[model samples]
Target: MKPIFKRPRFGTTSTAFWAATIGLLLIIAAVAGWPNPVIFVMGAILLATGLLIWQEITAGLWIGLSVFGLLTVLHLTRAATYFQLRYLIYSLAFAQLGYECWRGLQRTRDGIDSEDIDDENGDGEEDKPMISLVLLQRQPKYLENMILTKVVESAWGGDYSNSDAQSDDDADDGDGFVVGESPMFVIKAPAGMFLVHNFDVPYWDNKDEVVEAIGELRLRNAVEEHTAWLSVDMLTPGDEEPDLNEAYLLVAKLLTALADEDTLAVVRPESLDLNVWSDDVVARLLTPGAYEELSLPDNAPVIPIADDAPEMRAAIATAQQRWPEFADAFQQRASHDKADDGPSFVVKAKITAGDSTEFIWVDVIGLEPKFVHGHLANDPVALGDLKLGSQVEFPIEDVCDWCYEKDDEPVGLFSLEAIRQIQEAQQTNEQ
Candidate 1:
């Protein structure tokens, strides 16, 4: 079954239809001797309201309502002299404006609740995919031009064309550029049109899951404090399943070209999955078969360190000093959820055998005043007999760093921060 694609209905067709209808009615009223100053004022106000609505501006409704109320009071008080027929026509036009206002509010509410609406075919399914790219910084000024240029260089180069003007009639105002409800650029492709919009941070329904995904991707700090995001939505031409592969490829290309280190994360809102921008990941996305195959693992592989540096030693000293606080929180969480598996707790400690010492993450099962009891979370490269998941006990003084999942977010990863700083320094030096 073909998935139903849904989006906001405000487009060029509706805008043009309303404009033409209003223009024709105003012309007829003027020809019929209803061209008084009051009539002209009402016509101008109506035209202004239409233009505001075309730009998807919500303030237009209040403006339209205030003018309608003012005109009604003037007509009743005999302060303004306009023909009765003209008044009736103006009243009907105001009624249409009121309806548009209500509809716009409904659309806004729906968007807040869910970006992708349920299938109208009554299947209780939404097969269409929508991807959002979360960014730590505002998009570059020439993003629209960059997107167009990249699309023209892709395999589907000639298969797409810019349609920003057709999708949004008031995209460019006459005097100065007026930003509408949101800054967006539209591209018409063979399968459908792609709507790319830059907006403020969205309300994620699966916020905890998203946080968990970010933690797994080792990008918690990068996106944890983001203020803005970009959404890429595919609008199918009709009731046909969109070319999913093409959409993925196009999005991948855009990510490769536009996403910098500051580009924090990418997420499929419908599934609440974080995606890494890499060639291997893109190849997996383009593979055929079940969608379940595309789901990334929750836990990322443990990153290795060849030798402890000054930063690592400092992090370890800090963790030792803060061990009391960690123990208090760990005990509290364990007491709170004792009936269930409880929160995930891990501690990084040094393991020594003969002359070699290695630091590894240990899955904490219990904690004592002087010791931490747990199993190794990862394989040791230097240690011969110490395998992954091997039960181990270590002195609390040897703990280098500690972390645990709290509400799906990783907290107290001190060593992780040091690692990030070291890597960043290396990159800076190379550049």
Candidate 2:
């Protein structure tokens, strides 16, 4: 497999640690005239770590370290009486690595200059925004609250001097400060939106309103002129895009329109990328061939029936106890579906067993895939899941198998809240 690890981004925390570790080794090699083999090994490490840093300041460090270590190795090994000759090659390698690192940073940074075109949906000739978008699907409100607090605190406490120097440099370059005081924007759509917001907001409340309104608007689209009920069926092959997905595309189209009209700030989350979970729940539920099912929340607000719906409450609790993964996915999915209108491009999955192979659909349903409304499947069906299909296997196994064999259905998923209620219900039933 191509490397799973992301090469280090310069200016990140990890780069510092790597520098320090390499620094200590170099010092030992320099001071004690360590063995030739040990010295060469240290130099090799320096070369590798420098490349991984992906930035001039840090990458140069590795080159320097490598050259120093290499020279020390040559001296200790006594390869030649004329150390001067050997120094020439090591010096050349050092210069080459340094020049490459510096030029590479400029080239890469230059590509990202398209940040000036805020009106485009990050589709310009330049690199996609230096900004990374993350999705926090079907996350619990309690957990969100805790994490959000940290984000706000980090923003407030972060150093601004470097930011100021950078801004000045951008201005001097004629790019004219590609970004302002807020390098990041924070907005929340209770459900989710497929479109990333890109405008200035005076307060968090306004941002929240704009996001929530988008979700409300998209939900309106799903319903007909006069109907509380929504009709969803087997997705035709050509109907690759779901209703929410279409809503998101419309959102992108609208945002693109706005960008064309004005100089927007490009409202986007600071940490909305996905690093984990539920890649197959969508296919298992929607595809007929897959034979899995679930009742969607369908863009409705969760009217916290905290004291009312005894069954839902019980189900949440019981599922949490018996199937933590299911309960988590259920609650997360509920939040995701109810919170936004943007399409969360969920993945479609297919699984094959002894005899037949089946297709299933899975995805972040509401607008934005990130935020509260994410989940894996945990439907609690009748027959147990045979766990067939090699394709169905994923790093994230949030789905719970209830029925298999004759039932021949896929597993169900749930967010944490749903599992909590399910857990309670199971306890009640057992008692």
Which structure among the candidates has the greatest TM-score?
1
Error at 265, model 2, angstroms: 33
Tell me how far the alpha carbon of residue 127 in candidate 2 is from the true structure, in angstroms, after superposition: 4.6
- Model 1 clash count equals 0
Q: Which stretches of candidate 1 lie over 4 Å from their true place?
A: 1-142, 159-182, 200-219, 243-246, 276-280, 289-295, 298-431
lDDT of 1 at 314: 82
lDDT of 1 by residue, 1-431 (tens): 11222222332223323443454345445545456665555566667765665555556555655665555555434312433322333344445545545645566556532234344542212343443333333333235544544543453444232222322233222211111123455444444445555545433545456555542323443345445566555554213554566666665555444455545455665565554434455555445432234346333444444455778778888888888878987899778867247777889888886686778889888888899999899756446678678999989988989987777887788988788877777679979
Put down candidate 2 lDDT per residue, 268-346, tens digits, no spaces. Answer: 2322211111224233222332211122222222222233456544543443345444334445645666435432323
Per candidate, the number of residue pairs that clash is 0, 78
- Candidate 2 regions off by >4 Å? 1-40, 43-98, 102-272, 275-431
Cα displacement (angstroms), candidate 1, residue 403, comes to: 19
